[model samples]
Target: MSVVTLIGAGQMASALTFPLFENGHEVRLVGSPLDDAVIDRLREDNYHVNLRRTLHDGINYIKCADVKEAIKGADLIVCGISSFGVEWFADEILPILDESIPLISVTKGMLDYEDGTMQTYPEYWQEKLPEGSKLRLYAIGGPCTARDLSDHDPSFVAYCGPDFETLEWIRSLFSTDYYIISLTKDVVGLECAVALKNGYALGTALAIGIKEKLGDDGIDHNNMKSALFQESVKEMLELLRIVGGGVDNIMFAAGDLDVTVSAGRSRTVGLLLGKGYTIEETLEQLQGQTLEAVVIATRTARAVKALAKAGKVSIDDFPLLMHVDGLLNEHATLNIPWKKFERHM
Candidate 1:
């Protein structure tokens, strides 16, 4: 059995191990030094609290107790860290990793830099690696959630990267009867779709929150939500064009991922806002949790505005995007301009 080293002990990291073990792979999980308590709990209880599943017998817990030792002689690497932590973990493990081994990143989100450039995780990681490194980098995105994967519920995900051979091989290792895989060479489109959907899906969540607040009985506002979904897809298509990615590729990234976010925690942020929670109050409710939707929405809005100022993109092309950006970052109201969207219908 091939030994796979998973760097990060978060919910996704723990849940993803199930598929690896199912494929007859030995998993070595390396959590952050800060996650010692979680590691201890997993070891003692023989279960991952976040995943709510008993530990697979083939899995080995390596509590950042020895970073190098944890990763030694692994056949493959998978990073399931949060967007904020991916770079830190990359820095720690890059030196210990051989250039030949492939690193698949399940972390999704754009990295907003002080320089006013927003980059995908793969681009950020590639820039961080030492010069002349040939490390194969891959990314996973789309509708699959950790809970579903851990529970062996049917799931589908998109895999994209520059190395087709390695990507396909990694695909073979993870794809099960329950977990389906789709491949794409359009990394920019896929990564941007994955990251941008969280920001755009906030609008749909706002609609859900408003529906719940109105206490509407027997009146499914699927039309209203469909409108928000269309707006999100339109904005995502515009973004893909501006960033030199194909519009059709958005179906794989934005279309699939937006549906997932609508049904997941990413929607919770917008729901709180719709329920009349102030930004501060909402953040307080989400204390100690990293809401990538809120973070990405705020950062990407600024990044897009910056890109517009530089004349790289047309600001007027993204009204919904700008509106949501203002709502998330500038403390603007939850008002949406329905008049501006008549042409879309």
Candidate 2:
């Protein structure tokens, strides 16, 4: 049992404290500046308002001001913040971080450029540090959701870092029967696969949303849903090849898509859009929630356009993602682009 500190008291980060507390680690849940309300709730009642559950007493809740003291001797530091908080984390947390303390992130996202280049969250964080820093970066990927993980459900996820021994040690800090972890060194592949799934999930839900919108209680759109799933995986495979990631992590890609479509936040956005909700209307409905899918959809679409311009890849290969981008940004409706799929084989 080591001193495990999780920064950012968001849903996923707060939920992850379950494993750390259950494993008998001296866990510190540090709330970022944005999580003042969450920290207050935890301190007052050991309850996470978002998860709507009471946590164990073994955990220590710290506020943003006391973050320096909370991470004083933490053996393992988990970057449990979302992608949007990376810049803040870098500015506030990285400067005081010890290079020796292992850093693993629960953040799932990619930094895409117009030149067809992409970097995982860990890599992006590494670039923020001064050159020659020994701060090792790791990321968690796959289908595990905050709700499932918080409920102690059996969730499979991949932990990608550089060293096997170090990754195993990090896994030892939190890994339990229900919180299963698979180790891999393909950091780029794992991150790309997982982050890409967020966008595709919206498309998957469009199938369901459209069917439900028609008031057709007679038939289900599982066939269309499955087709979207297959096409999403295919585009993911093409992306892996383009972004210099391993194509063998197909399970991570497909598994994440399945899980997100099943219960992830992106599913809700997709459903609303599929049901003929306007982009502004859908966003207004989900105002406070973190819209990872919306951000990724637009970014992925831009990346594809950039790549196509560079003659690196064809934009036609990613019809689902493109349609998602159009749906969210271009105010395009739920046109599934069924004709664009299965053109490769």
Candidate 3:
């Protein structure tokens, strides 16, 4: 059993604590200044207000106020922050961090620089660490959701990093009978797929909603939706290739596109749109919830468009992604250009 320090106190963060505790690890959850109330409540009551769950009893679960104290002698550091918070978090903890500690991120999103350079969360964090540092960074991706994992449901995810040997060690540390871990060295491809999947899940939801609205009870539009699903994968692979990544990472679920698409938060927003709700109405409905797909859609679109302008990738290469971006950000109509889509490319 090793001591693990988890950063952030959101649903994903809270959900993770259970498995670690069950697997006989000493866990310390550290909250940012923004999470003062969350830490205070969790500290006093042994329950997290946001997660609406009590901490598992009979475990050495500790919550710390300061980052330095939380990670003082941690065997591993897991960042549960959202993509938007990673940069600030990196800056906050870098001054006190041990460069040799292994870092794993469950965050899935892309970073876009002002100059239009785009990198995945792990890549961005790796860059933010001191130059020539020994910090090994990894990211988890695939269909594992927080709620499912919180309930101890059987789940699997792709554990990706630079080396298989180190990743295997990480996998063993995090794995439980109910929580399965697979390995990959396709960090770029995995991160890109994870970052981009929420956007595509919204598309899948929209397709499902439109089919139901059209009175197809059989969900027989599986054919049409499957096309949309494959189109999403093609666009993902193209985006990966454009950004110097390989497409072989998608091999396991090669025939089952739905397996790769997680039931993400953005699907709710897309379902609303597919059910004929306006963009204003959708945003109004999702007022309190963090719509990560919305953020990724806008940011990734800007990054991809910048790449297109620089001739790194053509705008035509990602019609579905760009179309969904317009639908999300510009209040554009749901109508997409299906004719321009490449079915087998």
Candidate number that wins on lDDT, 2 or 3: 2
lDDT of 2: 0.88
- Write candidate 1's Cα lDDT for 250-297 as tens digits: 776565656655566678888887777777888888888778888888
Q: What is residue 323's positional error in candidate 2, in angstroms?
A: 1.1
lDDT by residue (tens digit), candidate 3, 8-86: 8777777888888888888888875577788777777668787777877643334444677788889988888776687
Please give the RMSD to the true structure for each candidate, in Å. Answer: 1.9, 1.1, 2.7
Model 2 lDDT tens row, 264-295: 67999998899999889999998888899998
Model 1 spans with C-alpha error above 4 angstroms: 113-116, 342-345
> What lDDT does each candidate get?
0.79, 0.88, 0.76
lDDT of 2 at 133: 92
Candidate 3 at residue 231, lDDT?
80
Ranking 1 against 2 by TM-score, winner = 2
Judging by TM-score against the true structure, name the best candidate.
Answer: 2
- Candidate 3, which segments miss by more than 4 Å at Cα? 58-64, 114-116, 215-219, 251-262, 342-345
Best of the two (1, 2) by lDDT: 2
